[model samples]
Target: MRPVSVRYDNSSVRVCMKKKAMCKIGLAVMLLLTPMMGWSAKRLNIVIIVGDDWGGPYASAYTGIYGRNLPSNVVKTPNVDRIAQNGVLFKNAYVNAPSCTPSRSSIFTGRYFFNTGGGAVLGGTWDFTIPSFPLLLLDAGYHIGLTSKGWSPGTPRNAPFGGTAHYYQYFGTSVSSFSKSVTKWTAKGMPFEKAKQTMLDQVRGNFEAFLADRKPDQPFFYWFGPTNTHRTWVKGSGKALWGIEPDSLKDQLPVYLPNNPEVREDMADYLGEIQALDAYIGVLLKKLEEIGELDNTIIVATGDNGPGGFPRGKWNLYDFGVATPLVVWYPHSTGGRVVTDFTTLMDLAPTFLEVAGVAIPPKTDGRSLLNILTSPLSGQVDPQRTFAITGEERHNAKARDDSLPYPARALRTARYLYIRNFAPDRWPMGCPYVAAHVPYVFHDIGEPSPTYDWIITNRSIPSAADYFTWAFAKRPAEELYDAHKDPGQINNVADDPMYADIKKSLAEKLLAELKKAGDPRVIGDGGTFDRPPYTDLKTVACQDTIPLNWAPGSHH
Candidate 1:
């Protein structure tokens, strides 16, 4: 029994004189480090929880062709289906640019949202020489932070995650304005479920102030980016705050959106802001099961794009505008499983640097799913994880005209989706009127509710003229689809003729994945994303009015 040496640090250094010799050196360092602790592998702790116009094949956990024609889920999200019943749910995820600052700058630089030059589109310009897996897990020491919208309406210039000094926002982003700050904190009298429980206690007081300001055992990486499911809510707050019955979502619409009752009460108020972000993700999964760090944390819910005032969902790449809503969760892996892997939130910055062992940055175009999340072989586990490749140069750099960037690119596979409209003579949505950034007329379809006033007052009525030419037409620079027979991509069988050899073999496999990712829009007369720091509309500045003070009565 020669195991009782004496020394215990607890929270600092303690040479161990007494206190029962520091409790027999914490019982001889737990019997000599409990069997090499899996070769010292406790780095995990990442979190993510993204969400912002969070899309998915409208969730029934997307079975068969990923929620084929909206499989189910009117909106329950038991804590986002209990983090997909404790992890791994991505029925084919995506988002290599659907909008929100180049789909969160391709999940903060796993790369390929057009290689994120000017953070590649939609108010772009955060390209601080790209390389930010949360600032490389805050330079490998970890303990990163971020609350509302992280790689945001870009132009931040630097600090991919350590900028606003590791940003927490005591409680500002006002829980991303859920129901307009709970209808202005229930009009100041404050009791509408106590002003929505103070915006879900501002998402559990900003992740308990970034886990009580990390330091001990460090290793964090939060991000929690909420956005109230991105868009102007409150038009009958999905049956007034989540009863969610716009006629029970009119048989789960989606035939190229244009169903009735004001677009089924705006798709039941965007599924009541995703059931108020699943009750703020069950208050961050009961604060990581009461701070024990819920099995050393990995979590990851997801979504950075899709469904913002519908119609080919947010800034279109289609597949419901790069549908996302992955899942993940960790610790022993494989629970309630389902992976079908062809993911891309730029494979989550090399899957958070291969589960924090970190180093995967040789111009990463995303790959480390860490053996398809510790594989248990769920359908399509990895077989080179098939294809994903989405793109869109500009979302609203004034849609077009002197700013022009509706350039496009896409490739999704597992039975094709292929598109390539690199400016099919422009106007794919923008300039028939409002050409300086959204104010009516095809502003890249979103944010004008009642499905943009029932397709702009039924554009000449003929059965709403094919729902206003499938939400503002302008195409034909190739577009194939057999995505297992057009999974609501609204049929664009390219130039038919027996799929012309499947559209010249998926346009040479999307131009060899944009010339193997040099992608200055196909690297030739691609016009380097067509001019000036990709049409540098003055590095998209101007943002001031931020006085929410966490809104509930907003401190008078």
Candidate 2:
């Protein structure tokens, strides 16, 4: 018919032109859509804040044993509270390991520490090949950047023990104080005022510069790691920030120690460090809002490991050492939902990708909490998602009296915790003479905190035995606790007949999980590496014989 009308009117010519123009526009739209693939939807921005060696329930709002003593206003963390108020707070969050490098490895790769080459802590020449959260985001056309530690010091760049660093090249790196301190143990203990000022100045400048320089066109993934909550007693620092004197903090002790006044004072300094860390977080949040990026950004705050100490925590399998605070705030998820399900730091990598709407690699051991964030009706994680496992190989050996370390693993569920100690005869805390760890265990023990003095002096008293055992006892093959009744894990129930079923069930599960992840201790019938090697071995070793690796780098 149109051919017959070849003698077209001017109107027909106009119609033809309009149709051709529409076709061109459609083609262009399709071409543009092609690059979008499945991520055409709005992308989510991510920011992670990691507190060094912070513990769970430290914030004032929680009623757990850890926070029971904090006055509503004792630790003024309005900003941290704001995050919890706006988003969900995970009540049972944990690290795969209680030590730094291993916990961080879990956070980065979304795999169990046993699965990672770093068997326990930063040593073990940890493998970095496992994919990281930031790396996943970067691959998805998002701008990835980190201001603090990404993949760290003890991790090597090879085989099962070594892996890849996703953020090394993709993200622009800022000199991080925490990472630097980890690299080389300098400035054992900076004066409180100087340390606080130094940290504030460096962190502020770094954050401001980061926000100022980020690429606007792409969504960003930024991590700000602060070195405050980790140790090396800085006096008077807590008073200036939290308005709490060292004595007041000592009075609010989480653990009672009859012997060490200096150790108690040191606890005050540690609490002060937490306060300072909280303050910097406030600063970072304000800066983000100033840059007009706070709302759309998803913020995650947690610790790299548990509190750095001896006995009941730190290199051991106890709530005080491995359990940590995990607060997440997303535009869609911030509604104060409290999740009691067990979750590990390893889940962080997958969670980051899922938030950004990226494909999660099958190799990842973590599952996204995004579904829980978006669906409040879904109240709990799956029942199978009931356990958390952690281990230890070596920390700063130079910092311990025992230069050669022990290997250990733990399995924790809602009510029960089972720890399998491979070398019960080995010292749990480093030896008193190994230079790297000597000062922290010996000189520093009586100087800053009572807990240390109490631990060392009362190892012989039967009533105080568990308390001391929590800190330094060599153990049997296994230790078990009913976390519901004993969150402190003061008693060993593994040998008790009453917990026979629990012990058997927990031990079995632990074995399965560990075997699945290929842990050497499990596979080799309980053998351990002598000590993980470090890049700065000689330098770190020279510092203390029991050298400390707590100082943040000068630039960070």
Candidate 3:
């Protein structure tokens, strides 16, 4: 509409006047919108659902294998699939470390695992001095609460980080009791199927209770850490609860695992646990919707690391060990898209802080994913997100008297994975002698699962020997894989002359990035990671004399 206009002294002055008028109008609109936007300008209720030891490929939505191939089996995750349909699914998400403590620490602090002092190792204490995103949210006036596992499998005793302060006091069923409760229910005349369902329901009930207790008018942050996908699943759970018979899954076994019926059954059980977790996620989503907070809340569902207690999966630098499924749903913005940008758990802390309008600390190693999250574009939203860095320090302290650390740093790109084993002489997994001798040992493969038993029992067989070697044998100093050509990462092309240039470039880049990040391994103080005052009583003993020409300052 051609309305009355004021004349200006010059065109530039008129433009400035127009901009000032628009700014004033924007400020007035923002002030009016403040109440609906919560206490702060970017206040958003955050719900992060973390599945313990779950991997990306297990998600039906990511692979489309669960529903299409195993329709009769009840390991279907229609609910989680729904989230992917309604939100942004990240295809190339990973954790900084494959272990529990380090992975969680990275997510909480927005720092690399190696940079986190004691947090770099399993059963080690997290340096509470590093700021946690949840604590920051709490200080920002958001009601924070966590259910099931939080930053755990590690002691948070005297640390200034005050573990309890991160979450508001909320009562819920303990995740530790999940096994006992299922056993008790089964013994009390309930069918194994019904008992398993009851156990999952209890977890969902805890989350519901947390939501119910949230104060009105206060934005909330809740960490829903579910133990459903963790190791030690009830034996025969797949058949008992989900009708997923072991024999029925012969054709669907993953390429990485042995195709025996036993391994298939284990896979089924694992899938059942993931399905149970997905069920709870569905319940949580429904609860949010019922309470009218779904639109305003940012729901992020991911796993801490890869699948646990499997060969070459968890506690290793393989893709299966570090790659995680990341699905983020913020209904008000950025939904129904698939992002292939490389993402690490380290990025989550800064992302959460950014969403809450809180300042991200300067020392953080992670870059915020706000741009990728809110962008309309799909694959590779950020050009800089081309690669992810992953490493491992000490996973299980109960391996031997030495509690040796398996230190390996890896750089993963869309095309290749480059790994540098700081101590190539040390076993990638634990020493086989210690593994065979130690009763109830928490070796690199993790808890005594069927896969561990199978590998150990069948080690004499040629095929089993090959599998064991691939999973546990000592690796070379430098190893590289063409990830695109070899998704299983079984073939090593590091020494292959054809790929020398790629290997050299990646190695140089990896070293530069590590140095820039202030990684202790690159610095001269890496030896401190191996020595003294371990949280576990088992001391770290060097089996061989430290080599005269060994990498200086290298530890566990």
Structural RMSD, model 2: 12.0
Tens-digit lDDT track of model 2 for 126-156: 4444545555555455655555554555535
TM-scores for candidates 1 onward, in order: 0.34, 0.76, 0.84
lDDT of 1 at 102: 81
Model 1: residue 261 alpha-carbon error in angstroms: 14
- Encode model 3's per-residue lDDT on 1-556: one tens digit a residue: 1111111111212343457776455445434643544564436889998889988456767764223333123357777777777778888899999988899888888899988777788777767556677766655557777777778877773122246654432444534334445656777888866766666566667776666666666778888787767887876776666676788777665456777877877887787778778777887888888888888888888998888877877888888889888888866565678888998989998898788766576588999988887888788899999999999878877454467576789999999999999888777766543322344223566666777666656666787777767776779999999977777788899999999999999999999999999987888866656665443446544243223332212212
Which residue runs does candidate 1 get wrong by more than 4 Å?
Answer: 1-49, 52-177, 188-197, 204-206, 213-217, 223-227, 230-232, 236-305, 314-320, 323-343, 349-351, 358-449, 452-460, 468-493, 496-502, 507-556
Q: Scored by CA lDDT, what does every candidate get?
A: 0.72, 0.60, 0.73
lDDT of 1 by residue, 53-155 (tens): 7885554455344544452456667776677777778777888888888888788778888876777877666755556777655655567888877877766
* Number of the candidate with higher TM-score, 1 or 2: 2
RMSD of 3: 10.0
Query: What is the Cα-based TM-score of model 3?
Result: 0.84
Model 3 ranges off by over 4 Å: 1-42, 64-75, 157-162, 165-180, 191-197, 398-401, 434-442, 533-556
